[model samples]
Target: MTQFSKNIVSVSLWITVVILFGSLCNGGKILVVPVEGSHWVNMDILIKALHGQGHSIDVIRTYNSWFVKENSTYYKSITIPNTKGMDEEFVDDMLFKMINYERGKSQLSAVQLYSYVFKAIHKTHEMICQLITNIFESAEILKTLKEKQYDLMLTDPSWGAGILLAHELKLPMVYNVRWTATGEGHFDVAPSPMSYIPITGSGNTDKMNFFQRVKNAFFYLLMDIQNSRFNLPLYQTFCDKYFHPPVSFYELLQGADIWLMRVDFVFEFPRPTMPNIIYIGGFQCKPAKALPHDLEDFMQGSGEHGVIIMSLGSFISALPDDFTEEIATAFARLPQKVIWRYTGKRPSTLGNNTLLVDWMPQTDLLGHPKTKVFVAHGGTNGVQEALYHGIPVVGIPFFFDQYDNLLRLQERGGAKILSISTLNKNTLHAAIQEVINEPSYRLSMQRLSHLHRDKPVKPLDNALFWIEFVMRHKGAAHLRTESYKLPWYSYYSVDVAVTLFAVVLIFTLSIFLTVRYMCVKCCSRKRKTE
Candidate 1:
């Protein structure tokens, strides 16, 4: 062939190859509306993973979010006006006060917390409505979403606004959350029997005694009542104001295509799960990256004694100074090195054996050979990571699911739980030593880690597949339980139970009346004979 012809042919071949590759990718446009704060970390993994598969992903999040990458991005970010605004100081303040409130005054009882939360629902609903209003008021933004023609929505249930957006846009949505699923919550798409599925914050276990079960049941009913009285009305009002021909929030929730729960059987007790609830636990976690030179050197320097990594995540990083000092004093007495993620004033009691930083690569440190144990606030992300790395924990849980997760870890024999309210240097030191000294803690963690890893497909891959599966099928409506369509009475079988009760009552009444008549007849016969 002539040289010019050869060059043209090669160019054509390259073009054909590129076209074929693009066709094979078969990417779709995906929209992700993450709940604010560090939750973006979990959203980041799925976003990047889907982006890697050549899908176009767009996110609507809080302004000045840490997840906002500057340039050369696989996804586009749209900042929306939120209650917290650009300054994160308020968030830190709230978390600090919350933790202190629980830790100082003792952890609030389930009823107290529920009542408090119930009272706060209206404010929360208003905040969420404001966030959604900001987006809806902008014709350009709504127009853009319409123009993009997104195939599916991956929503954070914590935010509570994404479902509304999905409904407004007439798109199928998948709910994802890190919170433990309490059956009493609005997202009761499946049956969570109060018998085994412990109440989210009741501090009850799967194996509950009679009194504990009673407490669990009370908490469960209390939440449902709270939701019906407070949350449902607020959501209905929001929907009515925004969307035409009002829809209840529960209706929107039940219409969800699937639920991607960040729960694992390794930490949670085996409970019946619905077809639509997918277990993508640890999807946020990745293979540990190489630690920074300073951290690496610090771990290596620990030698035989090893190191313990402590972090309360972004939300609770700013712990009270005095509170942290108590922890620091305990760390000082330990033979092992301690790396604590502290944003507060450096503790004066900090020991020579300890290192403090504003942030540390948690998973990386946990995965390190020189790392012995993790002392954390028992956040779900931290708990999952510790389990994944087979590192036992000294859990000082403060609030929410942390307490429940710590209880599960303790039951599993992979952790030692300490009450944050009563925390002192001595208790902290003792708990830390117990986890470290107990060989069973490490062994139990290793066994669970093995089970976690022994899955048919990697969690990340499984997550990615299910996400795309929803896109391909438009919506996984078939996967939804028939219970979603049933009324409350039918869903709980209250009607069936009542009918059975009535039947038994009628039968017993008939037998009693017949025996009474027989006795009367016998008496009458005896009197006539006399």
Candidate 2:
């Protein structure tokens, strides 16, 4: 072949090879440690999905600890130390103070009064500086986490403190918010009017009852009060530190490059949302074949009827003869077998059909065909799993975002709730029966489950792609805003502009008056001389 022809052929081959290589590198490496409950579980699954797609992953978590069940292979598990416990009260104080400060109101309460005392100890310290310090200091768990290198961060609000590490390292960050990002804390504080930036919703199509909606409103009010009083000042200071003299709420949230939502579009009906956010519904999990041997046997032993799975959550237990008795009494009349994730010793008498274990693979057990209903504490993790399997639930929400999630689920016509304070056999049985006999409820859950599982890409894949995207883009600068960089006044600049306008007006008026005085004096002098 001619040398020119050979060269063209080689160049063509090189171009084709590069295109092929680019197509092959579809998935990206990621490092994530959402060590906090269902949030972490979903995060871990996402990391694994990346690994499945032939991308490298490193996860940080606690190792085999009973409290967190912390261990991972696809990614290194970074266990953050809880030595200082946490400043929940301090956080709340900070939040409350920021709320009232924004309205330009006085009369300090709660920790504001305490902050005055605390401020005495650190007269040299600035609250905004302290808040930024908290973000960096939140990596208190990093002593254990530094063992691994991460390119990007995937965290939840509960794990928001973890974002401090990413901030300190100047890593690109994307947060997964499970509840309303902002709101009043009347019914529940986590999910509120402020949940979404544009302030619509996840578009779950599920609207709460009038009372539930009212409760949501109440949550936002409390949030407004607390955030306006506490977080706002720290936020404003953060803004001033970065943007220099001006900040807005919109700018504050826009600081993060991306925000993943724990909402299912199938559930949200019609709510506006911003471009940076994506809702990954039921990313918690999907059915995976049969249950483990013992669990499957236990389910079959339930006789003619299917079984009921009751779990308060990983944190709380079913121990104490008291709570056990409530379960026993509730199951007494049921013909179905009951398998409870028992934390305490066996009650003196568990019903003949009942089986109790310290813990069972919840998703595994729920996937069983014989599994009919879920008696859950209404945590986001458990809720997502149950919805994934199309299992109707009798919610007994304990705390956190559990109550709000349950309310939304019940409103959607799939789940029913019994108050934890008023829990008993009658209430339990009623909820169980409703979930079991209601075909429509089953249908609602199944339909939603399909949509949740029907994503263009698995949540894990999506997460991995973003993580790699951040690494490739060197931390998405386009996604970040200088809201936190500017001062409150400078952020708006309206005040600054108005003040400048007034100053110029006054200066011009003074110059005109002086010139007029000189002219009149000169004219009078000339007239007298003449």
Candidate 3:
């Protein structure tokens, strides 16, 4: 045969092999229902990774989605039209109220604050429930979704809408979870001891005194009440209407095949975990890429003192004018150059050393050699990225789980937490200076980074393996625990404990009665003889 013919035949064989291999790895369809804002940021990373693996992804987004765009190269979008969704305005309003309350500028009492939060959560959940209701009621959307025949449903369980959809379609479910509808995801599927495992909003660490433990218990109770009163009832209404044989929303949430938990023990306190819960924390983080020309020049200008980067995550672009002034004044006192991500009015106290921008390349800046300390809002993505890059943090937490996330780093000696209520120029500057000047903070964080990085496979790769494993096996039922199906009493063994106690009591009572009868007979005979 001619050399040209041989080359053609060899190339054809290689192409055929490649096609077969791709077919074997591909052809799995995933229906993703993700939460908005930072949760969407995490979900987007996973979606892109999944698409690279040749899986077809269909994402569900509300018409008012703040981040999940209608158009994307990696995934097809399924937009639901909802007039009232959790948009930026809603978040900003909440933040404003929360800040006012925290700073003692509002007339809201503690009770009022609790009431406001409850109402806000209730309203949000009601909207989500309605959105899910719309999906179910729409015959065309349901038909299209059912026709897609997705292999699995991958979702963030921060909202329970995805859980409802997964159950409705009878598809295996996987969670990209840190928080669930009720609280943190671990509490649902794992053994979370209230004695040491601190509740989300509680400022206590794993080590707690008696009073701290009491506070933790109270926080847990408050969360449970919120779940029962605010979150569940709204979703339960839908459950009653649509489900056959009736299943609680919590049940559907706990019955997922896999939970790709977004935190590892390196960042999280040591707590009990279940078999199916995979820690894929820092999966969204990567080695630093080249910064834009302008950013690189700024980094270079920082010189030996290094650069300090600050961001308040995706949601809060601007704080109150007074708060910004306080922060800017603090930045002025620092020797290191500052890159502050702000959209507020320029603070008059701003110094020549500080640079203000509407946005920043956050992860890349953290990864830079010249980067010294991170001034962050303590969002999970920012926290994980800082840990991934071995950078210490000066955390200024606002609302939600941000405080708890920062507290974890503080407990680990990698970060310092400053309260927004008490944050002034002096406090902010002190916190930043302490983190910068102290070598221990950087050492502790670098140690954590080493531990986080010391693994056989990358976290993203591990997550993908488990995701595809579910698709391959139809579902990971074997790894899933049956404890979720058990009632609360049964799960805690309360029934068994009660039963055993009753049996022991009955046995002891019978013996005592028999002995008493004998004693009475003997006494009667002795009296007659006398």
Which predicted model would earn the best lDDT?
3
Best by TM-score: 3
Q: Write the per-residue lDDT of candidate 2 for residues 166-278, one digit (tens) a residue.
A: 55454677766654223311112112242332222221223455555655555445555644565545445554554434545334344666666666655543454554555
lDDT of each: 0.78, 0.60, 0.92
Clash-forming residue pairs, model 1: none
Q: Return the TM-score for each candidate structure.
A: 0.87, 0.66, 0.96
* Candidate 3 positional error at 147, Å: 0.9
Instruction: Evaluate residue 86 in candidate 2 and report its C-alpha lDDT on the 0 to 100 scale.
Output: 21
lDDT of 3 by residue, 18-129 (tens): 8868754666999999998899999999999998888999999888888988999999999987535788888888888888888889999989887888788788878888
Q: After TM-score superposition, what is the CA distance of residue 398 in candidate 2 from its true location, in Å? A: 1.1
- The whole-model C-alpha lDDT of candidate 3 against the native structure comes to 0.92
